[model samples]
Each structure stands twice: as C-alpha cells, then as structure tokens.
Target: MTTDPPPEPNREPTPGRLHRARTAFRRWRRTRPFWAAVWTGLGGFVIFFLPMAPLGKILQVGLGGIAGMAGGVLLMAMALLILLLPGQRHTAGVIAVIAGVASFPLSNLGGLFVGMVLSVLGGSMAFAWLPEKPARRRRPRRTTPSAETPVSLGSGSA
Candidate 1:
C-alpha cells in the first residue's frame, strides 16, 4: 500500500476574518498609545540635544542660552512629564502638541524640525487611539405558537 503524506510539522488552520480582525485590534490596543507617547518624548528629547551640534553651538554662542534653548528645554520637560505620568496622558498629549509647535523658534535646527513632526504625530496618536469594544453576542430567540391553539383542562365534555 502507498503511504500517505505526513502532516506538516507545525502548521495550523488559518483563522477566520473575524478572529483575525479581533486579534489585530487587541494587539493594536495594547501598544499604539504607549508608542505614541514614547515617540513624543523622544522627539522632545532630540530637540533638547540640538544645542550640542556644531551649527547649534555657533548659534548658541551668538544668541545666548535664553533665547536659543529655552523652548527646547521646556519641550523636553513637557515630554518627560508625559512619559513619566500615566494618569495625565491626555493632558500630556495636549502639552506635547503645544510644546512641539512652540519649540520651532527655540533652536531652528534640523533636529527641531524632526522633533516637531514626531511629537505632533505621537501626541495626536496618543489623543486619538481608543480601544475597540468587543462585539456582543446575542442569544437566539425561541419562537412560541401565537393564538389559535387552545388547551383543554380535561373536562371530558367532548
């Protein structure tokens, strides 16, 4: 007799569309908000470090720290607060967006440009990412006979 082919070692049945969608939602729900906040913080931190660059240094020498770097420092502080405080993320998201916009004048460096973009994206994502509610399962209804059918109490009167 010819031998049947062996089953694939670790293969499993593919999930249905609904199952796959639900799984994707669960994964996104878990990470999207956290990553958004992280990006915002990272952007702000980058803005803070722009001063160490050669171009930034030259500008720093000319403009002094107050006019050149204060906005970056403020942005960094706001980002750090957002990262450190979980309960205030909504507020932090608002702050991050504001600071990212305001930081434009701080250093006017490439880092500020990159940081502004990232912080805006991250802050908006943080504000907008909401967890999806699970679909509720409904019970099937049992149909009962309506009207017409009469029941006798065994009177035997025919």
Candidate 2:
C-alpha cells in the first residue's frame, strides 16, 4: 500500500471575516453579561460541593468559621496560582490534592495509621508468596455408602 503525504495548511480568514468574528464575540461578551453572571454563580455553587474541598472543607478543617472564610480565600488564591500556567489544567484538582495531603495530620491520624499499616501488610502478604498448599494425596474412598446418596446409582450400578 502507498502512503499519502500530509495536506497543506490554509491559514487565512477572508476579507471582513476576522473583524465580524471579533465584533460578534465582543457583542456576546457584553450582551450576555447576565448569562455570564449566572454561569459564574453556578460554578461557585459547584465548587462548594467539592469533596475534601479546598474552599469549604479545607477551611473547616484548618480553622473555625471566621477564619474559615480567610482560609477559603487563601485556598482560592493558591488555586488561582496553580491555574495561571496554561491549557486546561484544573487548579481545583491540585487544590484537592494539597487538601488531601495537608488534612492528613489534622484528623483521623489513628485511622490513617491503621489504614497505612493494613495496606502495607495486605500488599506484602498478598505478594510475599505463600508456598502452595501441600498437595494432598488422593484418598481412596471407602466402599461403604452414605444413606443420603442414592445407593443404587453410587454403589451398585448394573
């Protein structure tokens, strides 16, 4: 089979296309401000539900309510910093990670310790390799029949 070469790239917008596109975008950003606001509000509402979340759970775990607000704000600032560098990375995901790491010492130390020990033990026990069970010699069955099994079928088939 023959392979085909790649096609050439066409990189020009014709005439007033770019201008119209920019104008349309600007018009959208301005005219749809209500939708933008609603979306922003919805996003915040969703963020509020993050598990072991940076903004809420972090604040609650890290400090009391008044300080919780401050903690939440700081968490958001950290998220914004994580978000600054690029194409479609989630600061919240990173924040969740940090929160997971940081919250370790604050609560459930006993549970954590137990879980770690159990996990390690489980892994080691799982893979340390037990010897195969000693192969049992096949025992010759007794000719005597039990009452439950049909004696004719089991013992005296003609």
Candidate 3:
C-alpha cells in the first residue's frame, strides 16, 4: 500500500477559519504561560501519585497523563482570562505570566499561591475601580388647576 503524503506546512489557513483560529490561538497564547504552567504543574502532581491514586490503575494512569496536560491548560486558561477580563486586564494578566514562569519549577503549590494572590488583587481592583451610578432624582409634584380653584361652576360661588 502506498503511503499518503503529509499536508504541506506552508498551505495557508483560510481567512475565516484562520481568523477565528488566530483569535482563539491568540487568546490561548496570550494566556499560554499561565495555562501551561498550571496544567504542567498539576499534571506532574497527578502523575507522581499514579501508583497510589485509588481511582483504579486505568484512572490513575489517566490522571497521570491528565496531570501533565493540566500544566498546558493552566497556561492556556491564564491567557484566556487575560483575553476575557476587561479594563484592568493588563494587570490581571501578569499573574498568568508569573505562573507561567513558575511552571518551570513543575509545582502546583506555586500556582495555587499565585492564584490566591491574583484572586485578591482581582477582587480589590474591581471593588476600587467600578464607577457607582448616581441616584435618580424624583420630579417635583404638580399642583392641579382644579385643586387651586375655590369656585364651583354649578353652585356659582367664586
């Protein structure tokens, strides 16, 4: 049997799909370091416990693999958050960057700590920056002409 040739690397991705993909990719990449670090770190964590993880050998093995992937997702997720969150997005994004850097240590503990710190920072910034809406003013009550009139038409009193 003849082997099929591999697709060309230079073939351009379609603009529509490419644009969508680029958008998604940029989102993923922008948050890459965070997701990668987290996923990789978590993956390492799960992989290390594969033998004793009680989910059965299959699951344990699965988790080991998953843990490895967790680091990847962690980075992607971080990039994704930067894309998703607005306003203080740039500042919020640094957490992902730090986490991505920490991923080299291959430790989830580091990510957990960083995540906690970022969460507090995110909350505080949101609390401090959100503009409060002004209260609506109530209109003044109107006096009707009838109420001011002392004369009754039928009684002829003025």
lDDT of 2 at 68: 26
Order of models, best lDDT first: 1, 3, 2
Per-residue accuracy of model 2 over 110-142 as CA lDDT, tens digit each: 124332232223222222323345569999988
Q: What RMSD does each model have against the real structure?
A: 7.6, 22.4, 16.2
lDDT tens per residue, model 1, 1-158: 89999887996778999999999977754744667767887777676666655766566466533433555566556556655565566777787787777666655652548978877777776677564567799989997767787766798876
Error of 3 at 78 (Å): 1.9
Question: What TM-score, over all chains together, does every model reach?
Answer: 0.54, 0.22, 0.26
| Per-residue accuracy of model 3 over 1-158 as CA lDDT, tens digit each | 99999877886666697799989987655432333333333433332332333456536556433443454455445434533554444554455445444444443443445533443343333223333346789999896778667755695556
- Displacement of the residue 49 alpha carbon in candidate 2, Å: 13
Residue 67 error for model 1, in Å?
A: 6.8
Cα error, residue 30 of model 3, in Å, equals: 14
TM-score (C-alpha, index-matched) for candidate 2: 0.22
Q: Which candidate number has the best lDDT?
A: 1
Flag regions of model 1 displaced more than 4 Å. Answer: 1-32, 53-87, 109-112, 134-137, 140-158
Better of 1 and 3 by TM-score: 1
